[model samples]
Target: MNTVDEAPRTRRGGRGSRRELRSAIDTTMLPALKRKLPLVEPMDAAQIEQIDRASMDILEDVGVIFRDPQAIADWKSVGADVRDDDRVHLDRGLVRELIKSIPESFTYHARNPANNLPFGNDYSIFVPMTGAPYLRDLEDRRRGPTLDDLASFHKLSHMLPAIHSSAHHIVEPMDHVVAHRHLRITYSSMKHSDKTFMGMTTSPKNAEDVMDMCAILFGDEFMETHAVVTGNCNGNSPLVWDETMLGALRAFCRRNQPILCSPFVLGGANTPASTAASVAQLNAEALSALAYTQVVRKGCPAIYGHYLSTVSMRSGAPMAGTPEISLMNFMIGQMARYYGVPWRTSNTLGGAKTFDAQAGYESASTMMAVLMAGANYVWHSAGWNEAGMHCSMAKFVVDAEQCAMGYRMAEGVKWGDFNEALAAVRDIGPGGHYLGHPHTQANFQEAFFMPELFDNNSIEQWIADGSQEITERALKHVNRLLASYEEPKLDDAVDEALCDYIARREREIPAVDALNNEH
Candidate 1:
């Protein structure tokens, strides 16, 4: 929690340094376009004012459904109108109070200072949620995720530079005790990277138990550096806050910890079978969370959590990383801005098959959409596919490169006081290329460029190089990176402390083998 710790030292020399090798295999990726794409563009100022007014009206009149009696009573004590034991009517006055308490931003510590990332208003960072897929291992080609697979995925995620944090126990690993010991396991992995947060279990009590363990790991100054015990909250239908979610919210507020209040609004499910309705649902859930923040502690630091997915009408399965999902993230980013909250959304994904066009197209499209939409922080930006059912280490490396490409795109055209560059452009005039200019050589790295994840080589060279497809290339790249990865150095004292914590927790929560055993 001490924000004053020294930053992590920068790593010396990696693949990133060899960015410009002019082979067709190395053509830099290019951003598709540069323009704001909004759900409702050019809504007049009056219309904008109307939406805000109407939203407030809904907060007060239509009210939000609160499934927790305690949250309702708490709101009632604060003078909010209570409709029932569970639903609380929140008005603009209450909303404003909550918004005031939330902080503009909060910092997440890195073991090494360089890895630390600040989340709030002006800064955004992305960390992927790993697990759920590999229903069968590709090696044994087994079905469902096993403990070893999950741990491997965790380590793979640990190596990503762009993915700033890793969600512990991505799926139910074999070490079920460690499942609850996520704080310790996460802290261990976190020794390698600075920003570590957790995916609090659906059960609020379980979430709290894990957080209590983390608090010990962090000592007294916990909130300042850790990702905090931020849980996911999903609405059943028509988008309403449930008891489980409210409990987590109240706990965080009471403890003065930040909450990642995310609502997974499936397009065509729990929402008006339309993308716009899904957007409305997201906005409503966010506002409700914002209102809760003000009520708990006026202006308490809260993150804008928007998770979007689509249900296939035919298969009844959730489809993530679709273009529609990315669009959903983009619109949600705007909603986050409207409320002046920092946003957390996920990036596009590869697929059930790690190395293929399906993965490439999906990841690329989603990344471009979210970046342009101005999403500050992206979760699950790399790895996992087939509706979060599996993860690919190879894909993780490829996605890292993709994320870098998107970040480069986001950092577009920085114009400065240097009239020299513009004047030089004028001097070079029509038909004059900058390829030969001294300034061009000096600053091309600063300009737009792509990546070499695929074989940018000419057909002849590609054929000569074994006709390796993107997937094959990505696999090789991932293994090479993993081979060179060095385990992070942690103080012996801290490591032992974490070990004791996990052992104590295991004694408390015995493993249940027969529970929820579906593959």
Candidate 2:
């Protein structure tokens, strides 16, 4: 343990110490949005105008199904075309006016009193992924996560490092009534996290309930920073919106929370059964959602979230966390930039069965795309497995290291004269190793990356050392991080207050009796 503790402590250099290496990276080119990857070009100014016109036409002609009576009344009172059944048609002119009124960027306050992070150009956040395929029980057995399992998962997530924000309702399998409880547990557990994601479900009442929770956290001032409770509004391909979710979206937007337009158009599911159509559907939905969001609040911190996957027809379930998904994430990121908005994507790195090569490959591939695409945020960055069905705390540490490396990669390389050494190459001529050079001694630590799991040795040396595999190395790293972990420091009074808030809410929420007697 002491030896491992000493490993990361060897380099005590300050920031900008590796400027030489950073210079080596191409400043103009973003590798994450390379040309080989499909870049969804944004519509030209005229095309965008046309799409807006056409979308308004669709809204007015086809109209959207709105079951929420209040929402229908609000629209109708505002001069929208409302049908007898509550299908409301919004005018293009009104939408344009709404889009024009929204602001482009905003800040989200972290629960950490020490930090208040900004979300928009040049800044990004990474959140842990939730809902793994298998739940590791105290008895050491692994199974699907029950509602109770989510409590443990949420608590652990609040403890992990580098998880700045989060998605809501990580685990399901409870009645709709339990959904708010799940949200409460997440909020209480994520007292350390700066931002929280909202899962609106299919209930408008739930939407209002989510807003109440946000108000509790941020006070009435939450309306300004309330963009904290970002809601993901996904679409069904080329032009379909889930009416149940749309109402929730409108509610969230009205509250001024950030909106993450997540469009998960699986190939063959809600799409033309082709990857191109899948991408097109994702692209179109993102555009429509953004346009709508802007219409609601002109510049309301919006992120185009692309979570596209291929469908396994035989299984009839979405094939999530696939390589193509990551590939598409990279492409979508470029497209997001085209629209002048930040992008958030997910990478499912670990799984329930084991944190083996399969986990490593899938996680690394997706994460590479995230880093390469220069995404604004990468959620589910670590500890996700079996397609977000399980989470491993050990894997969480391993993935944090991976994310750290990704940051290093994003930081780019260092470049300078003198072969990256102050001494001349001629002074330290060819074939004369620079390891002994003073410049090498001074700068080598800054240039080199000490990987937690990668082995840098000859085969004979490796065999002589331990004959351990990467999975074993990663597992060891996980256990070591857990053993050596120190809880993040917080003001005692603040912690107590937040905990009290959670306890009070927990007490007030009605249980079985309330459920049975509900009107």
TM per candidate:
0.81, 0.73
lDDT tens per residue, model 2, 1-519:
233344234223433433433233221211121122333333455644444445456666766555456555556665777776666666666655554444445666655434455665556566667545455443334565555555544444443444555456555423335524544544534552344444444455566666666665556575765456666666655455666666767767777777677766666767676544455446655655665665455556667776656677898666655766665665566556645677778765543366667777777877777666667767777677666666665566568667766666666554753455655476777777777777777777667767656788999988876787665565555433333323344456655655565566556665544433432
Q: How far is 92's C-alpha from truth in model 1 (Å)?
A: 2.8
Q: All models: lDDT?
A: 0.61, 0.58
lDDT of 1 by residue, 273-314 (tens): 866556765666677876776676664567777667788899
Candidate whose TM-score is highest: 1
lDDT at position 449, candidate 2:
67
